[model samples]
Target: MTTEHIDDSAWISDKDSPVVARLSQLISALTNLTMETTEDLQVANYGVGGHYSPHFDFYHVTIQFIRRSCQIFCFRSGNRIATWLTYLSDVELGGATVFPMVDGYIVPKKGSAAFWYNLYASGEGMIFLRFIALN
Candidate 1:
């Protein structure tokens, strides 16, 4: 499998998923923002007693991003302005997305999503977890 800044189960290119179009349309309509391209759909599988420590969603950018495979379609330097974390499965126990700097964390459920800007004034974020926007 192709590896780089992230370590998870596997990723499928979002190019062919019908859900991608639907999601993009919904997000655009709701937020009044235009999305440019679809990134790979990462499928994160949690093994028995599996865990990922506190982590940041968007990683630190190196000086050179022009040659990175995960960069973009148009070949431009990328900055993470926003992030969408969608939970495909229900987690009854201990899986939660947490931000150490912002004092924020989320226990995700199936069909539920959390959207947050990757950075903020205090170097974190104000997340919008679907229904409720956290500030």
Candidate 2:
């Protein structure tokens, strides 16, 4: 994906995991966003030097609109306003969720998660106000 820089990921269904389902619900209520706010749970693995480059979640700009074949075949989808990522495993090294501009980061702890809105209250800018480094 253009926004995510990672080696690989496996999608996990919340329905198959009670913990994930509950976390999704909690995030929906807490953020005042729908449960749809949660992307599919992901089981991601990293090898040597694995890391995700900084990126934003929501669609920022559109290239064009209503092209002939493109628009005719396309279906609308919701804009992502936030992200919910919970770690299902632990990394002894090089695992963290970081807000670089803020100089903040969370070392991985199994079952811990990181959540944040992608936009400002005005809905016009990044809410966290910086690059969030997920590695």
Candidate 3:
């Protein structure tokens, strides 16, 4: 399976607009996570045949160590514990989120969202919980 990493064209914060603020609030409430623990909102646009290869949302052990050490002094949140993906548009053709390990597949629909845990309750990354997107 080929892999591709495309940076999001836009990144919006809650403070940038009321719409994003409301979306952030909804994400927080749904995930049961505080705003401080969440990252800024990202918007990615995919054209025909676009795709995202399988990947994990949480950091690796070494990166987690560095991040945790930094967080001790910087007072920032640790590695990602969960992901809440909100679909802003519907796809007429192929656009689906897939989790191969667990045989999970989610079709894109406007105003719909998918949520999943990336880490265990003990803060360890769930290795089999990787996902991919086909567009």
In order of appearance, the predictions have TM-scores of: 0.61, 0.66, 0.81
Candidate 1: how many backbone clashes? 0
- Candidate 2: pairs in clash: none
Per-residue C-alpha lDDT of model 2 across residues 22-120, encoded as one tens digit per residue:
877787787687775445766766555667776555655452344554443333544566677767777876777777767788787887877777666
* The candidate that achieves the highest TM-score relative to the unseen native structure: 3
lDDT-based ranking, best first?
Answer: 3, 2, 1
Ten contiguous residues minimizing lDDT sum, candidate 3: 1-10
Q: What is the lDDT for 123 in model 1?
A: 46
Of the two candidates 2 and 3, the one with more favorable TM-score, higher being better, is 3
Q: Candidate 3, residues 16-44: lDDT per residue as tens digits?
A: 98999998888777767887756678788
CA lDDT, every model vs. true structure: 0.56, 0.64, 0.78
lDDT of 2 at 17: 90
Q: Tell me the RMSD of model 3 versus the true structure.
A: 4.1
Instruction: Kindly list the per-residue Cα lDDT of model 1 for residues 1-135, writing each as its tens digit.
Output: 322322346765446787876787776676665666545555676644555544344434442244456455325534455667677877776766766555667887898987766656564433332121111
For every candidate structure, what is the RMSD over all alpha carbons to the true structure, in angstroms? 6.8, 4.9, 4.1
